[model samples]
Target: MKRKINCETARNFSIVKALEKLGHFPKKSNEKEAWFLSPFRSETQASFKVSKTKNRWYDHGEGIGGNVIDLVCKVLTCSIKEALSFLNGDTLFFSFQQQQNLLKKETGIDIIKVQEIEHPALIQYLNSRGISVSIANTYCKEVWYLYKASEFFTIGLKNDKGGWELRNKIFKNSSSPKSYTYIQNNNKQLIILEGMFDLLSFAIMEDVLLNTSDILVLNSISFIKDIEKFIHKYIIVHLYLDNDSAGKKATQYLMNKYEHVIDKSSSYRNYKDLNDVLSYENRKEI
Candidate 1:
C-alpha cells in the first residue's frame, strides 16, 4: 500500500536536503543552521538560511521565511498537493538524522571508507559522464559513505581541506570542511573549473596530466571569492565554468579583476558544461 503524505509529514523533511537536491549547496554549515546562495536569485553572498533545529528556511534576500512545505512550494512553484507528492517521493530514504555522534564525526554525511575506483556501478557512472576508468582511478577514489544509516558509494574527489566531493548517478553531496581542491603543479598557468566532473572532462578532452597546469576546482561557485588571494599569481587563468548565468557572471568578474583571465566556456557554448559536451560526444559514439 502507498503511504499517505500530508503537510505534517512533509514539513518534517529537511530543508537543507531539499535545497541540495535543487543544486543549491551550502556555502557554510554548522549544527544549528546552514547558509546557501538564494535559489530565487543569483548573488555573490549566501543569504538563504536553513535552520536544522527548526527544520525551516528563511531567505533574507526575499524577506520571507517558512517551513519545508513552503520551501518546496516556492522552489517548485507548485501547489500544496504537488509539493507533498514531491516530498513523499523521496520520503523513505529522507534522512535528517541529527545524531550527536554523527554530527561530531562529520557535518552531514559520514565517510565509511575510501579506496581505488573499481566498483562496477561507479565505473558505469564514470563512463556515462565520459570519464575513463584509468583517469578516474588516477584522480578519484571509491568513497563509501553512510547516509540514512545505509551505506552508499560514489566517486570521491578530495579538496585541499581534506573534504570530499561525493557524486554518483542519483546523489550529489560533499563532506565537512568544504573547500576548493587545488592541484598545484608549480606552473605559471592555471585552469579553473567548477566540479570534479569538469576537471575530469577537461583531462579527457585535453589529454593532459594533472601536472600539466596548476588546476583549481572550485567545487562550488560560492568558493570563488575564497580563491581570490592566489588566483592573480597565475600568468594565464583559463575558466571552463558552466554556460549558465552564475558561471558567466563569475567569469566576467574575474576577467575584470585580473589580467590574463580567459573565458574557456565558449568552447562548449552549445552544451551546459564541459562534462555535458563530453557526455554528448560519448553518446554519439554509442
Candidate 2:
C-alpha cells in the first residue's frame, strides 16, 4: 500500500534551516521574528522577516506573509504535494517497486548521472532560445537526469532548486508558465517588468541610456501581488508594465493606489511594450 503523506512532518521542515542553506543567516532574532535580506530580491536591507513563534513570514519589502509552507511553496515554486514529498525525502529516490525494474529502464543509472557543463544538446538548446552559450553559462547550468528516468536539465541561480526561473531568456517566449527574475543596483531606484523579454529589453535600453537603475522581472503579472510591499518600500519606483489592456489595468490600479509612484511607461502609449518600441525604431543600439 502507498504510504500516506503527513502534514505535521512537512511543517516540521525548518524554514530557518532552508534559509540558512540558501546562505541567508538571520541577522536578527528574538522570541518572535527573524530578519534577513529579501530572498526574492537583491537588497541590502533586511525586509524579509520570519516569525519564529508563529511559524509565519512577512516580507515588508514585498508585503507577502504566510506560514512556512507558503514560503517553501513560493521559493520552490512547487505544488503542495511536491513540497510535502520534498520534505519527506521522497524527491531524492524512487520506491522499491521502481527499483525492481530500474535496470531494465536504466532509471537507476540516469538518476545517478551528473550533468556536464558542455553537453552538446544543452549548448544547442541555449542557442535555440536566442541566448548565448556564455550568457547561459554565467546564469545557469545543466542538470543531468534530475527528473525520473529522463535526462532533465535546469539553469542555476542562487535559489536551491536550479529549475529555469523563466525570467529574461529570449527562448522563453511567454511569461504564462511563471518564472522569477530579480534585478537590482547600488542606487535606490528600482524597476519591475512583467516578462523576461521586457526585462531584457529594459536592460538593453538602460545600458544605452547609461542608467544604473535596478530592474526586476515579475515573470508573471500575477506576481504583482507578491511584490506590492517591496514596491512601496522603495523611494522611487517606475512601473514599466506592458501597454496591453491587462497591463494598463494593473498600471492604473497601482497608480490610483500609490499616487507618488511614477508610471514611466505611460509616456510610451503608442507602443504595446518597451520591446516593441525598441524593435520598431530600429534602435539596435540597445
Task: Kindly list the per-residue Cα lDDT of model 2 for residues 1-286, writing each as its tens digit.
Answer: 6555467665655677656533356768887778976555433346788877767678865567776667756655467775566455464331111111111111232333333347664555444334445644544455333334444333333222222342221112111123456655665777867754455455556654326666666655556666776676667778888776556777788788876667878666888787676566544543
lDDT of 1: 0.77
User: What lDDT does the true structure give each of the candidates?
Assistant: 0.77, 0.54
Compare the candidates by lDDT and give the number of the best one. Answer: 1
Looking at model 2, residue 167 earns an lDDT score of 22
C-alpha TM-scores of all predictions: 0.68, 0.44
How far off is model 2, as Cα RMSD?
13.7
Candidate 1 residues 1-286, lDDT tens each? 8777797777777888776555567889999999986765334578889999999888865578999888877665467886686666643322221211122123377689999998887888789788998988877899877766877677889989998877765445567777889888798989999988988988888866446788999988877888987787888889898777677888999999988989989899999899889999999999
* Residue pairs with clashing backbones, model 1: none
* Decoy 1 TM-score against native: 0.68
User: Which stretches in model 1 have alpha-carbon errors above 4 Å?
Assistant: 1-107, 209-211
